[model samples]
Target: VSRGQAGKPPGGPVPSCPPSGTKLFTSTVHCTAVLEGFERLRQDGLLCDVSLLPGDGEESFPVHRAMMASSSDYFKAMFTGGMKEQDLTQIKLHGVSGMGLRQIIDFVYTAKLSLSMESLHETLEAASFLQVLPVLDFCTEFLISETTLENCVEVGRIANTYHLAAVDRFVDGFILRNFGALSQTAGFLRLPAERLERALASDSLKRCTELQLFRATCRWLRHSGSRMRQAARLMSRIRFPLMSPQELLHEVQTKTFPRFSPGCHNLAFWRASNYQMLPPMQPVLQSERTRIRSDATHLLALGGVLRQQLLVSKELRLYDERTRLWRCLAPMEAPRYQHGIAVVGNFLFVVGGQSNYDTKGKTAVDTVFRYDPRYNRWAQVAPLNEKRTFFHLSALNGRLYAVGGRNAAGELATVECYDPSSNEWTYVARMAEPHYGHAGTVYGNLMYISGGITHDTFQKELLCYDPESDRWTQRAPMSTVRGLHCMCTVRDRLYVIGGNHFRGASDYADVLSCEFYSPAADNWTSAAPMLRGQSDVGVAVFQ
Candidate 1:
């Protein structure tokens, strides 16, 4: 017999068997040749047992039942589920176009899909109906990767309809992360009611004032061919209570189409009236120096007791070091005195204080609030576990520590720490003893608490609490005896601002003197004094 007929090579050389190490490479070559032969059988329509008649097309694709059934659940069920289609040579697919069917069938045989934006939707729909999970997965992944804020709404709708739960969630998250940008896009203007509801309910939405949200919603409704009938229903999702009344009246009432209902108007009016009834916003007290260095330093003064006006101040103010100008900030919601304020990163946290608005300073409140100067807005956060006032508030390692504040029971030596990440407060090690009005400041890694009033006695004892060690060590006493004063760290040095100092028996005064303690020298030296004497002052350092 000829060599070809004998299944032998037609080459000139007849060599001996190769080394055993080359057996794996020889097996791989044989496997590839077998796959190529199968591909040839498919292309030439050899041993074909089935035909797929794509919708409304004259051409029918001839395929093998085993190949089709192996790649698609629909074909497998037809051939094995005792269906009448099992006996037929041709199966007609309805609702799917000829091109979409071709794409799915090609992927089934080749395990590949070339998708484009133009044909992606139709192909996915066909794959979904045909139960070709691989192609459907490919299409969904492609759409998700290409999804932008401009097309996320539509993509999300499709994903939801196709029951692609994972893709749907991804689209929703993408929409929320880019909500600010998407809100102004055409996709947002045409968003369906269900998707809009999902977005409105998300607390993780980008932080924007209610006024901005209102304006953006109005813009969307006013867009061409928008369904204005849904305006009131959509606008209701907005937290109207969180907005200032002036914002509601002007931006929402005057500008929004289809005027708000009488109930909404009444709600806005009530909130506005309440805001106006509260104490006026306080402006920053400018420094005596007209011009200062080009430093970005700023000082924020929060709530305190104004003895002269008998006012429990909830006002907030910011003094710019570079410009030497003071500007007004949004006031705290609760009129407070003897509150604790500290800066942790960009946020200013206002902690426990006495609510002196009605009783003129009787009850201490446990409410805590956070201020974002970037937006000039304040929002209430998790309250303290213990209601306290005259406490020392300091931010260390991105946490707020409240130490030695008096509750209804009297002065407290208890210590509580706040973590912004969890938005909760936990009690830590107690102080050596209960002391109130004792100033606390964080310098380097340790928290230092110095002079304050405890049991009607002015203290001069200085103590340092190490967070890492969770222990307190006594430090040298301050030369001056003071209480209700403010302490801050500037340039790595400890500073004591104006405080109530006892001049003699039963004689108290607010001292204008300021002093800095150098850790290296272990001594105190006088720094520039304030323009005036002030006590219960809230000090904030912004660098």
Candidate 2:
């Protein structure tokens, strides 16, 4: 009788001897002698008696029987036709074991398979059914290399369903590469009209307008098709011409349609076509006249008034136009440069500006400051997380908004707001682009920002910010790009003044250009030029 290795017996006792008349070898005998003696006893017709010794029970049958049964079932399910009810249609299988059926059955039973590019497609399908995302991703990557325009749509749909952003991007790039083959396909360009409108409304339109599709659309409008009539009506409602007279004439000569009536050549076409030639005169005549009256009164009121004053830096001179003009009424408690200043009741607030560095290369003050004009005193308030300089500031409701500005690192797209009651600074939203040395003015609830530097270059982008929604929307662009500009509102109209083109190597060559922005029409029209090409000038309007 053989003994098992050292361990407790399963299910209670270990068996120590063979059944009746068995030959038992002592531990001192050699292993070969014990095996031969047992064989001889079995051959000699001597029956062996095996029984478990008390306190030496260390063998059991159920555990070994269960292990052998499990392995047998696994083999049957894998190699034999035992797993008949298991579905393999959705189950992905990979690798060639010289037998497809054998490989599939092996994978179904053991959840193991070889990975390869040729079998990736089937594997992906199976993995998706099993909800094995890691295996599915592997298969997707293998399949992505073979993807073409024909299969990209299917690939994109699957990627989108799985929320695989990387795969979706790859599919999009593939489609874009084969755009010509898919251009006329409805699936290629089909999108909701609202989405198309949004894309047109985006800054991407600045580049999209240069594309062949946009130009083709413009050309198509010249023809007398059903779309042409609809387009003409739309243009008329928006006070624009659908096509030039020459373009319309060419279209009429080339194509025939029901909307191409002879009477369509009425005075409206001539009037719309000749609108640009009406005059070279100023378009803001009425607004300018009103502005002149308001300016005269504002200058008269501010000329003699004395107000509290705070000196931010030696180069900057700030004073309240309501009172006390020339006196050092208050000392600025903190450093500020090109900051936005506002006054709510008797409290004056300054927000966000460039600061000087100390000897240890630390910033001095990039914070907001509050000053009591009544007490002629200043105190440091909250600091902005971002530092900005040469930005525009305006007050609306009870909050102060800081517009486009430049930091020591250069121009920034950041816009920040401060609440006096809370004594905290919060970043609201950013502008469409970085603009510095610009002018900002508030009318009603909207803040208008215009004319600043883009890179080292000047730009005339006119943008508006709505603090309630924390969003910036672009209006019409200004006619001229200027920096160090001043903005003032009078009679609901905004007048911009006294800014120069601070480009070129020589500073004295700056040009005098001034413009006005009309909110009602969302347009900029030329006003009287400034008396001089001046930068860093101050302007204020009050009646």
Best candidate, TM-score? 1
Listing every candidate in turn, what is its Cα RMSD in Å to the true structure after a full C-alpha superposition?
A: 15.2, 24.9
Query: What is the C-alpha lDDT profile of model 2 across 433-510, one tens digit per residue?
Result: 788778888888999887877777777778888877878888898777777778888876888887777456645345
Candidate 2 TM-score to native: 0.40
lDDT of each: 0.74, 0.53
**CA lDDT, candidate 1, residue 74:** 89
Q: Which candidate number maximizes lDDT? A: 1
Looking at candidate 2, the ten consecutive residues that score lowest on lDDT are 289-298
Clash count per candidate: 0, 21
Candidate 1 similarity to native, TM-score = 0.51
